[model samples]
Target: MLRAAFLASTLVFSVVPVTAPPPVDSAVDCDYYCDDRDPSLPLSARRSPHRPGTSTPPAPAAVVCNRYCDARDPALAPSNRLAQTVVVAGRQVSLRFDDTDAMGWGAIAGAVQPGDEVWLDRSFDAGVSWGAGSRLGDTAVPPGFGDWRTMMFNVDDWAGLGVGLLRACGRPAGSSTIACTSWYRTTWNAWDRRTAAATALMQRYNLSTGLFDTTGWWNSANALNAVIDNIRLTGMTGYRYAIARTYDLNRSAWQGDFINDYNDDVAWWGLTWLAAYDLTGDSRYLATAKAGADHIFRFWDSVCGGGIWWSSSKNYKNAIANSLYVQLNAALHNRILGDTVYLQRALAGWTWFLNSRMINSSGLVNDGLTSTCANNNRTPWSYNQGVPLAALVELHRATGDPSLLTKARALADASTTSAFLNPGGILFDDGGGGDVPSFKGIYVRGLAALNRALPDRPYTSYLRRQADTAHARDRSSADSYDQPWAGPFQRSDAARQHSAVDLMNAAG
Candidate 1:
């Protein structure tokens, strides 16, 4: 076998480097651990077993770019529309438009210079009625521009840099270029509204006990996630007070009775507190996380060989609770309270999860393990795929294993397919009501974390498209949004609104 492999080493393959189109998340490879990626690199598919050859197999298909231009006049042909050349990043780029009926519908994005002009030919109604408007100078930021540097921590209704967004001006006031500046990010976020929506939801749904009655009842995990988001977005003392108040009501986590009575639900609350501690530096949050982690671990035993039960009763083992364990323990090891025990348990738990065969074919994850220790043929929920996908990413960071990224990439790729995403790459899942409507947002949030670890334009573009769709289609007259991201308002609630906030916030 060794001699046969030696003969296959003579094959030659051409190497061509390509720059990634969108900005990579600096936390992943760009800033600290720069795992520079060149899209032109060929896939690792084997060539041949018999002999070395001069010919090379074709490179994997390039990422497909969806072409869409919103024009006021559908009657005007694309060829007839004037194409203007603008210098963006020192290269003269053409602003092209096609004949289409979409208005405030399609989005285009790119970097821009100070003198660059981005104009839209708008028609309010029929294709025959057309009017034009152009933005100028540094003030020419696209509607919904995402440059946080200029107005950091300040209030502005300028949405965020999502789709169809052009660049903001350069620093020190002149010569603006979007070439390689982290300050000039192109994002698809609706922080102003999304954040506002979340706050409103909290106010409307929150009980005096600090748990939210999001829809009809209080869901422990859902409320925990909301509290974390509230802290993350606002960092206000009021939200922290509520968090403390909630613990006062449900103080049995340390005594092993957890908030919601389910191990997975309790794990979520624990994970949220871990994040809360990360943000606030309060030892109380850390202590709570530690206590809950202990409670969750108590469920682990020889049952189903190795895994945590869905609840303390030990009736069934599942993906979410175990995945959260992996993430929570690994985070504890990395962050403030340095504990290797959590790390050791994290590794062991992740192994059991993988060996359990919960991750199904098509590169997606199933719901949980069956009573017989096999993967339950349950429908793939977005959160199920999301939590595990995020856990894998954390494991990759902890271990520095490249294959972990390969596994994550497979799941990410599968997530963007028809099962979880729409044709425009908008996050899509069965909005079958209850907690189901809120699932896609969790998946999107996880994907955003993945992007920060490993930057990819397709992933960013997918997010931007969804945000644009939401901006154009999802919002109601009163600024409330519906469950399905692809349309007009159907029904509105805290869970769905919170989910929207998650998606739009991650757009940045």
Candidate 2:
């Protein structure tokens, strides 16, 4: 279903004009000015005489600059321009950075007017916070001017320790509302960011426990799967040791063989092992996957008509478990030679899942069924839309059914284009902590599977857009990534890192 038809109660994705409201204006109007004061002076030392007292200035840090503050506009070079965003009424805010000079500036064009104002917002902490609105290089459009720009400012802090995030912001004359473009990283390099993210993720790996630290059991399975895919996709052999290390160490830790009460958990590990087997052609990985699949199938019963229970407690039947069940079984059928048992099980699982009412009217699958086997109509997470695509692709491979690809494409198209799922062309998730952080990775991993199986390879551009945005905006200096792939890096952990890694792999 499209997000508009079935919006989640929490975590709504809307494209508001402004990401953050401007700080409250002081009672007295103040004139912003650019003075002869050294740009290297601390911001507090260089504040304008009429600056508002109520506005809490950014921490005292030298405003390093490479060129004269009001020198020629960097946008004139064209190649120095990094990114741009439309604020309102076709007004484009461009972020321009000159690598040689280590300076950046903001420019506004396209429907510019005399009263329009342009300025730069610089943040040392990846745009989490910046000085009280448009403090640096604030400029107003003059009569007959076609475009306007802010004065150049340093792209880094005084210490040059971290790359700063800069965005162009503007307001038309007489309009109280202010709009800003999305943040752009000063040191923007997609390949470098991907490598750094993958390397940093391995640093969080716990060699002793055989799992990525700072995440849970199922999350580790997904993380390991991402690492495996990264190796398989990029042919990076440095982290290959993690494949056997995780399996050997964790295999005996939980239930002695990657089996637990949660069917989804077992299925995740099963899929992880399947990826490992595919990468290395190790029979042990295949055997372990088969064992895990067998254990998950044990939860299948007559309850909810036919689908397997979510856990041993049998409290509910959810989309994730059943979707993973179908994918795992169908994948096994394609892998094992002359395996009719798994093939029949996969077919039966798909038939039952298709008949179930979990899939809503909009082609999106809800969380699960209610107590009476009706559609629960819960939040249709990105992952919920994902695994089914992988399942259908596997089913198509096993039976050579053309209709399976048709169904998979519909779900993929709905998800990649949906406003709620992929707002502003970027995948949206609240990242409300815990397992939610890992959900996007699982979604994209499944999407990549479908992309590989298709002859047209349709989802390539969509996946690449996601990878590029995350690499540019959602990453930290240490190469860790946060939940939101768009911007304003909040916090990072193993789950978030692995999810970003999954995107990098898929994009390639």
Candidate 3:
């Protein structure tokens, strides 16, 4: 009977754009915590050898690019109409059709410069499209650094460096150059130099060790680097060790410095490692990913029904974390485990999203849950939208489920068509107002990944057009690629408060 029910639920849906209104409350039960519900049964313990002749899995889903570019069906050719570039990090960077349409948060980041300004605007209005770029004061800064000196520091800041490196890749577009002194970077270029150093730094400080660091074990950048080193040295320890640190281990040490504690952070770093593993085919990294996946499955709570909570705490469940995990799991599914079950779990989680979190008044995903959902919070985040759309594309491939693909298309359309985005195509910062170029980069990567996963889809052309725009803007401009210059404004009060380190790292 269970088999029949499962088979009946397996329906291949075509790409359907949902125009219905969002549901107030929808409950879906896939034994969300089945891994935890049966404590005595471990993930490894529950495994059964693959059953032959079950069925080939579904294809990956498709997503849109930077908000303006839509996924074109392969049957139909997509038109390539590009837009002007915006000035970010003190240079003119192409912004595709609109601001957010090119590369998002990443658009704001370029090769590190000596005196580049990292702006932070607190009263940013989401509705007001244009205004003076607010200069966020640097009230609080990490210790040891006297001021924001790009050259003086012994260790390069990961956040800033990551963005700079990504730009070098011409990832917002695509490039043959590795280190972009100008518009394009060579494949053999030094883009990985800072990345390796940043990874080493995080590990050296023992910050990346066991999932949790209650005692501030890996708190500082230096300390965290040590922990990362240990993991890299030893073979990737399986899921238990990784999860213990990320979930409970880190949660044990709480200081309220950041709203998100170690758990939230692990989600970010874990994915980072996973990406490295994907690129390198390192077995140890895969082992660590499995451990992280186990922890999430065991402790995952349906606080908002459709998503997992930020932490064990009852804080609002976020879309980004869950979405990140889904993508990680999907990528690691075939490599980590023996068969399609791992893919099944990823599908179940995504299905939950379609039923729960991805709904607004218009039935579209209204970004993520607002702090106001249960507590005071804001609704809508570009990252939330961009990341999930990318993940859905992956899910579409894993299960070949048309419904997943349909949902992804709808969200992609919403992201571009939504009024919240600037006319220039930049995502409204914090869903308020402001043009943060970094998100544009992020969107580009997400869209690109989706296009890659779904080769049959005609979305790549739309994405390529956006990439070309980013390329043309930074063309042959050595000044744009030069590292930032240092000045009083470099260490100004505004930069520190915004935690420039965190944002900069993601872009790279």
Q: Write one digit per residue (lDDT tens) for candidate 1, span 439-468.
A: 777778777777778855447877777777
For candidate 1, which ten residues in a row score worst on lDDT?
1-10
- Model 2 C-alpha lDDT per residue in residues 1-508, reported as the tens digit of each score: 0001111111121233444445432222222311212354345433221212222223425455434332346655334755555566667666677655556777888888898878876655334456532347888889988888887776554343333556667877777666666655444322355555566576556555666655667778888888788777666666788898777766775465687667887899898999889989998888988998888888888977798887766778899999999999999988899999888888889889988988888888888999899999888888898899989989999999999889889988888888888778899775353567788888998899899988899999999999888877876544668889986675667778888988887887
Number of the top candidate by TM-score?
2
Q: Could you tell which candidate, 1 or 3, scores higher by lDDT?
A: 1
User: Could you tell me every candidate's TM-score relative to the true structure?
Assistant: 0.58, 0.63, 0.43
Indicate the residue-level lDDT of 9 in model 2: 14
Report every candidate's CA lDDT: 0.50, 0.71, 0.35
lDDT of 1: 0.50
Ranking the candidates on lDDT from highest down gives 2, 1, 3
Candidate 2 yields a Cα-based lDDT of 0.71
Off by over 4 Å in 1: 1-191, 205-207, 216-227, 230-241, 248-260, 419-424, 431-433
Going through the candidates in the order shown, the clash numbers are 8, 3, 95
Candidate 1: residue pairs that collide:
108-164, 144-160, 145-160, 145-161, 146-161, 161-187, 162-187, 162-188
- TM-score-wise, the better of 1 and 3 is 1
lDDT of 3 by residue, 1-508 (tens): 0000000011111111212223222121123221122233334322111111222222111122222322222122222222223343333332111111222111224443333322211111110100121221212223333222110000111221211111110111122211111111111111232232223222212213332111122122112322233334333222113322333333323332111232434454455456546545666556655655655565465555555655444454556566766765676674665667558667766766665544665433443465544322234555566667667876766667778767767776676566664234433333211112223434545654555555475455544443333223321211111001111111101111111212122222
